[model samples]
Target chain A: MHALSLPTWWIHVASVLEWMLAMVAVIRWGERRGETEWRWLALAMLPALVSAMAACTWHLFDNPIELQGLVVFQAGTTLLGNVALAAAAWTLLPERSQS
Target chain B: MTVVGLGALAAVDPSPLFVLSLLPYLAFLRWAAASKRFPPLALRGFQFTLVFVAVTIAAAVVAELRFGQQLADVDRLHGSAEAFLTVANLLVLWGFSRAEPGQEPPDPEASTTGPSGEQVLSTGVEPAVPPEDGASVLDPE
Candidate 1:
């Protein structure tokens, strides 16, 4: 909160909101196209979303020494999210080649 | 003892994880680039996420070396890194939204009539039937 400037907070909040919107939009687009596999893409987005939240929470606490654990959690989730997203993208390829 | 162990683990540098994430992301980029059917803009967006990681790492290094502070403690550098992620995400959303079924240019002949006499385009712009009650919110019309 007070740890970050107003514009910084705006960027943080907006990125979180935008990421959620992207997940929802992707899921809806998949459903509309009758592609059940797209749900995996949405599910894969969760780790990144959690990572963003952890970053925000760490900042919200004013980056206290006690909550340094959140930073490690954030990094781990970011790694998991990247790997999951890669796998999810691969899932989209097979069906796409067919259509 | 448990608290001490947890604190020690937390104190371990998390930077290595960020660096390691690049390996999988590069693999993702290769797959996306090779796939003709993958949304082009979405592919670019994914690539830009790599840029975000790079920028964040640079910013973190500068924060520690120049200012003797963490990236999070330096608002401007942190915000700049995050801005890249925001752009990357927006591009992903835009690219996916533009993605139609089959990832082909629209053909007028691709439209077929539903049982209710409404037109359903194979492009995926229109649904064949209205979603029923209790359908998942992910069902968009």
Candidate 2:
């Protein structure tokens, strides 16, 4: 198995940071909208955070090529996480006026 | 093959297609924000599409990882991330469309009517009655 590159590890770290920022933003948006559902959206980010951490660890310490499968899995999970976040955003954001 | 096409393009450059894939998601978000009537079905459809794309891209990546040597030209990794995000945006659109509006406040002036004739009579103020049909209350003409 090939060793993981520095870029791969960096990407994982970046993803974690991005997700964290998004989580905070979503929560704040939810509060402004008086939406209680934002909690669920924030909670959804946890899995992606965990996955990113795991993937980063695997890439940095383990065989990167073999870790490809795990990376793909985490990416898929992140997709779902993003969807949930989006849902919360929509729910909490003000709707456009019909007029 | 479709994969070959993706690979060939990726070999030459991967950024353009990756950006293209993201366009749909961005468009979806814009539409959802601007739209007035958020239908539930459309939202679900969008979500399903995103999840589908995400799964497909992930599968493609796994395939590439297993056969990376053969498809060395393909930037499967980058493509997968783009596809995942695109699909995620679609899901957001779906959820937005499905969201229901909050309950509206009750209308005023629905419950109370002005003081009736009997009440006015009790108060010693004469109540003016309107003419019925063509007949005038003030004059018979």
Top candidate on TM-score is 1
Task: Report model 2's TM-score to 2 decimal places.
Answer: 0.38
Name the 10 consecutive residues with the lowest summed lDDT in model 1 chain B: B109-118
TM-score of each: 0.78, 0.38
Task: Give the per-residue lDDT digits (tens) of candidate 2, residues B28-123.
Answer: 445544432233443444445456456656665665787663221233554344344444434444343233322112212211221223222322
Off by over 4 Å in 1: A95-99, B1-8, B102-119, B122-141
Kindly list the per-residue Cα lDDT of model 1 for residues B36-116, writing each as its tens digit.
Answer: 435677778878888887898899999999999988899999898888988998888888777665453343322221122
- Model 2 lDDT tens row, A1-99: 134344444444554565566556545534433445657656865665665665555455453443444544454445555555455445534342211
In candidate 1, what are the lDDT values of residues A1-99, reduced to their tens digit? Answer: 687888888888888887898888778766655657778888988999999998899899899888778788888898899899788777756445456
**Best-matching candidate per DockQ:** 1
Top lDDT model: 1
